[model samples]
Target chain A: MGLKEYAGKQIEIDDDGFVVNVSDWNEEIAKAIAAENSLTNLNAQHWQVINFMRKKFTEDGDTPSVRALGKLSGVSIKELYELFPKGPAKLAAKIAGVPKPRGCI
Target chain B: MSKEAIERVSIIISKGSLEGVYPGLIMANGARMEGIEANLFFTFFGMDAINKSHYENIKVAAVGNPGLHIPTLLGCIPGMSALITSQMNKTMAKLDIPPIPEFLEMIADSGAGIYACQATVEMFKLKKENFISQLSGIITVGEFYQMAAGGQIVFT
Candidate 1:
């Protein structure tokens, strides 16, 4: 509910495909992510990634597990992390352009 | 320059280094920023940047670069490419600039004209899917020249 609690929540997915809760989400962050990834369609996969990313960020105050994500997405771990500099939660949430998770900024 | 203009700037991109790649990317991106109609025709080694498989895996060769004197033995090591590329990419990232694929995607999404040379496409046996999905189409040199005739041109 508050910024501290929000930051502590899981906002993104780890490299291992585990849920990472995010405490907050915002608009500028969303647009920046969307623009960075050039995501054309915010389909189910996008949501899955975005939601997980936010959760991961909230829970850890860091981006999801990059190496683990590569194993999960089938994209080279190197390539996957490179695609999202700010990590999945921020990028996915940005692309979805949704409100930050329940309690995030 | 408009489609109807006769005098245009033209640029030919033929290198594939991180530095080499910059000429084409910077020129094209800069051209679009200036409201000039720019056409990027990727051929030979330059095609690596747009080739779907190599887009994200692009690397800079240290040997024979005329800039770096890295030993050939060291140059051949695994992970070296990733190390060099990550550094280049990270610098670009810090500047808030997107990678080549992302930049191309944004430009293509914005309606700028992009073409993979037919000769090169055939040389590499590249298909439409080999390049990013946003390309308008593969075109011949004749067609590329037609567009090049009226715009500013630079060769990287």
Candidate 2:
């Protein structure tokens, strides 16, 4: 893990670039991370997924899997891919300031 | 670990039994979850995985499967395969693993390519309609190799 500046704050990040502390997350930091990952826009739909991920992580202590995200996040699996591109669950979890989800599906 | 990361994977499923098929499906799905490109090639009896009639009813081979720990002689009894298959299905469900058809759908929606072998389709008198809609196409070994280019090839 290492510290990197986002939204003018030095936040710890993991090797894969996920935020190390969930508490350090803010809208500005999320936007900065999203911009760095080539997601220039965090529209309402994008916020829907990001907020859902953060809520789940806060309540359940882990991010949801892709299948769970598709079924429960009010975002279809195909659209989640559209929003996050390569890996929906992992990317969304990263942007939401959560650890990478565990599980295959 | 190698300095180079795996960017893509081609998994070949050549068996029809439940145990034989899930490994390939799980691996391909796992690859997609990791942001790696994935493709599944179903050949020979593995076609049952994509076959419209058989994909949902795949059985566990009770006979000659030492993992089951049952006497081989008893495996020949009627209903043995069905009994074991139902038990395994319940276990998988408890683990939140979807059924075969649903799993295939999830993999496809994740943008992994799913295909059936051309030679196997011909030998089995199968057509496009025989496969699940998630199938990318009926492709030959050569075409599969093209999809597998620049990636790891796994057989399960």
Candidate 3:
């Protein structure tokens, strides 16, 4: 019933402890994440931005703030709302293949 | 089009106003966020924005900006530029955005390229060392256009 019990049952934890396999991450979540990260679906823009953000985190050891992410993609912070209606952390987490951000809850 | 199919964009930072500098930096930064390679070429007065000493310190002209209204008496006043710039900086800081220097650093760290216009640099007698450390290199307009050629070019 609690989070712990679900961990090893129907859901499994990935190596990073960021997300658990829900088996229902869903197409809507997928599409929202893709758009939020700027993936065109034509050439994996979503994956590229997500990968670049991951690389930046790996090298800089910091998740880029929204402003920083916006700058990198020539998108405006005002415009970011259209991509991730749930916000970047939520959307980016999904696209980056990571779990939702810890503080998001 | 797919991300792989789209060409990267080149952003031109051409304005000298205090309000003008941020547009170029922000745009370039945004381009990188979208996974696009972005290059910023600062020329003329725009050069002052990237120069280490002046960029952080520059202020907007409050009276002449046309958007600002401080009464006609203040329009002709000599110190209005400082007043407007100071107020603008306060607003930006409150918004939690970095001031220009730190913003430029953020852009550089994000893999956004910074370039100083060679002609503008020479005309102003600015040496490479005068620029912020973020610069990829100083280059000619032709070279800048070459990098920008097929890609989208934005002038801010």
Candidate 4:
């Protein structure tokens, strides 16, 4: 389930396709994962959401919910789907190198 | 990616207050977050949650709500409900919880099935136009119960 090829760079990922090591993630890895999910051309809006989630995960030890993302990420819920599609919290958290959000489902 | 362990969850939204509406929304979105399919059944006063016009303005049900920890007598005081709602909203903002409408939009976009109860719509004379666009459509109890078969069911 690894999409490790980022311009020939390799990194291990979990079975759910989330990067296993947070530190292994960088701009290239994030871009690769985003494109793999059919979200190409990571824009300022994309990076803003990703960076905010990463920062939140670092401080709170958990990723915020879709509700939280919609509120604090400077992106509306409708726009989030336009950017990440289906599940923005899950997709963005995976790209941002965070665990699946706790108690979500 | 390996398959997620849980597949489907059906949640019932039965209360109209802000507090009640959100738990269902949060849980439904949570299920989608985990790659689990989700269905929401809006019934009784809960139908207010799906009303395009009313849902946006839902407020905390402060009076007679034990969760608010306001004594019944104090809760009757003037402006108490609004004050409590204002405080709750501030804390929710700090926690980054979206308002009811945004949460509903997130839920729908996550592929969660939103079903309004058949009986309630008829009882309230609610037309299809009264509902938000995301509803899978109004459904009978028999249909919803069948859809909920073999899946976890939550009542809110």
Best candidate according to lDDT:
2
Instruction: Name the top TM-score candidate.
Output: 2
Q: Model 3, A1-105: lDDT tens per residue?
A: 222222123323354333354343444444543554465361344454566556666566555566655678555444444454335544665555455443200
Please list the residue runs of candidate 1 whose C-alpha ends up more than 4 Å from where it truly belongs after superposition: A1-105, B1-8
Positional deviation of residue B48's Cα in model 4 after best superposition, in angstroms: 1.2
CAPRI band for model 2: medium
lDDT of each: 0.58, 0.93, 0.66, 0.82
Better of 2 and 3 by DockQ: 2
Better of 1 and 2 by TM-score: 2
For candidate 2 chain A, which ten residues in a row score worst on lDDT?
A77-86
What is the model-wide C-alpha lDDT for candidate 1? 0.58
Deviation (Å) of A53 in candidate 1:
28
Residue-level lDDT of model 3, residues B59-153, one tens digit each, is 77555556785675676688777777788888877766688887887667666688999999889998988988878999998898888878888
Best by DockQ: 2
lDDT of 1 by residue, A24-95 (tens): 345344444465457534454555565555555555665543322333444442343344433433344344
Each prediction's RMSD to truth: 12.1, 1.4, 10.6, 5.0
User: lDDT per residue, candidate 2, B17-39, as tens digits?
Assistant: 99999999999988888789999
Off by over 4 Å in 2: none
Q: Give stretches of model 4 more than 4 Å off.
A: A1-21, A26-87, A95-105, B1-4
lDDT of 1 by residue, B42-124 (tens): 77888887888887776777566546567777767888767877887887776556677777764453335677889988988
Cα displacement (angstroms), candidate 2, residue A69, comes to 0.3
Of 1 and 3, the candidate ranking higher by DockQ? 3
In model 2, residue pairs whose N, Cα or C atoms come closer than 3 Å (at least 3 residues apart or on different chains), thus clashing, are none
